[model samples]
Target: MDFGLTIDQKSFINEIAEFCSAHCKAIDINDLEKRGADPEAIEQKLAAKSWYGLPFPEEYGGSGRGYLSVGLLIERLAMGGYPYPGRLQITMLNGLNVLKNGSHAQKMDLLPKICRGERTMSISVTEPNAGSNIASLQTAATPKDDGWVINGQKLYSSGAVGERNIIMVAARTDFSVKAHKGLTLFLVPSTRPGLKFTRLEAMGRNIGGLYEVFFDDVWVPNENVLGEVNKGWSAMTKGFNVERAIVSAGYLGFSERIFNHTVTIANERYGRNGDSGKRGAVMSRLAEFATELQAAKLLTYQALRLADREKLSIEAVCQCKVYGSELAKRLGDFCAEVAGGIGYRMDSLAQWYYRETRIVTVGGGSSQIMRNVAAAQLGLK
Candidate 1:
């Protein structure tokens, strides 16, 4: 199958590259390890270009770009050394979720803000006791006279810090049924009286650090419910496919960047060396990484194309996530090895990627979880 990008797609990528050149810089691994990008600044730059609306419908002030386009945009931005703007990533998926599952009023109120980059949102599903086993999440949302009362704790909510104004919370609304069937989704506001957030110290991707959020009898109006009660698992499943695909694309782009950097370093260090053996060895390793990166990119784009056609396949998405994430880690390892002692230093791009690659395997969904998903799709027990 042909994997060439269309002329329009190539042009758009070039535009993004130009934008990155003007507003973004090569990230400092040490600084990023401590904190994330400034949300306000990132928002301003993105909004100026109307990039915030790339994946949304035109009525929502978006550009009506397809999902594949969004994925390409993300990959290009990440490849340019941008932090990937956690809020933008969350907002893109959250907006799609809201558009698909939210009530009319919800869409009318939030979509415009999302398109304008005036609002930030996050998905809060993982809890202290439940990470990959989402069905086991204990967060509960009980119906009351006025609304639903939510009481539970969420962990590792990446963009749920003060930056996020809206959080799509997953909770158990019914206990009599199976855990997955009894769950519901709610759009809870960060400013709600009973909601609180505490930051979690993490090793990398420090911007909008991981958060531990506590909901103590927080009341959400019935209108805030997303999709049907107890049917949230289906909605979440669709969103997860989208999330994994975008994440995979981002990994592919970042890994390509790392590979390119390594090649430059290898050439600069060993270019004039008389020893053909050492030089050939480094070149071989680089060639292998380049081949893997290309394969991962194709897989990720295939998933995105499936999403565009609304034929999202769990197996394809899982394959992309697992392969792309693992490819990133492998590339990081190879780059670090080539850089030697200098790579271990805090300022080294190789060192930073090595640390950052750890999260791609764990976040969105772990590699183990992806394999299980693929197995299930194949009718394996």
Candidate 2:
């Protein structure tokens, strides 16, 4: 895979970095968590700039820049220090799913709205019982007179309901076939009757926190079924690869922030003793972190390339997810230790890094799952 980016791509990435640092500076996650706030102001700013359409097709009211640009935008946002594109990421990715699989009318109706940020989208996959094992999801959608009534619950949905927001839910339409075989994806309005959302308190990255969604007899017509019935799992798996790649990119950006913060603190502490950060041991460790971060970026970019081509290699994705998340975790740990008590403060960047980094290894296919995937792809017994 080519590591060099086009001049336009490079410039776009720099532009995104500047925009995120400037626009996302005021987005306080604590405030969002407390108030259950949605980042609508930031959302509107991105919309006006047409960034919400950066990667979709021109026919869908987008810039047609492709998925690589989207990944870069996310990476820059995270490195810009706040990394609060929680809803944006979810919307763009699930929008891609709709673009890829929805009917002609569904695409015409929803895709343009998605690009314009008039209709945000996300998934509700994790259940009280199912985490990484998506195959066992028990949400049921029974067909009734040309429509379906969904009845079940989901956990860790990204955002709360909005008048213009839609959520993709996976439900078993045919329980006769076991596991992933009988599931279908449906797009339902967050404001639809019988649908509910309750916020789930979380550690950090709490841009409104995760949510618990309840569906009681929520109904969607045949037009709302995403992809072919029973083919939902295929579309979902494809989107999972995209999500893992983007997440790895985010981790790469955050790893950069952690490294910069740690080094600055170390330099100041060492200089206080007149060593002027001339500590060779400290420098060596920092160098190691920088090297690892670069490697993670490479893996993430490679995965993004596969995502663009729509020919994702699961093994390659596992490599990106595993290495990038683990690298971020390591950098966060190292930074917290280097900064000592200064890092432990509630308001400190070090503490924030430590908290944010904790979730990397747990979401979107944990490190253990990634290793298992890699092993299977490698033909290991």
Model 2, span 1-381: residue lDDT tens: 346899999898888878877887787755666666677788888888887787788998999876678888878877775554467777887888887788999999998998888989878999989999999999999998798999999998887577888899999888899788999999999888999888877776566457899999998898899998987789798677777887788788888878888889888876557464456667889989888877888888888888889877898889989998999899989889888889888777788788878988988889998898899888997
Q: How accurate locally, in lDDT, is each candidate?
A: 0.84, 0.83
Please, what is the TM-score per model? 0.94, 0.93
lDDT of 1 by residue, 1-381 (tens): 457779999899999899878767743546644664444665678877888889888888889998889999889988876775356777788888999988889998988888887887887999988998899999999989778999999988877755447999999998899889999999988888898888788766666667889999999999999999999999898788987898888898888788889998898777966367888999998888878887898899999999999898998998899999999888888889888899989877778777778788888899998898899889999
Pull out the clashing pairs in model 2.
Answer: none
The candidate that achieves the highest TM-score relative to the unseen native structure = 1
- Model 2 Cα shift for residue 357 (angstroms): 1.5
True-vs-predicted CA distance for residue 99, candidate 2, Å? 1.1
Minimum summed lDDT over a 10-residue window in model 2 is located at 270-279
Clashing residue pairs in all predictions, respectively, total 1, 0
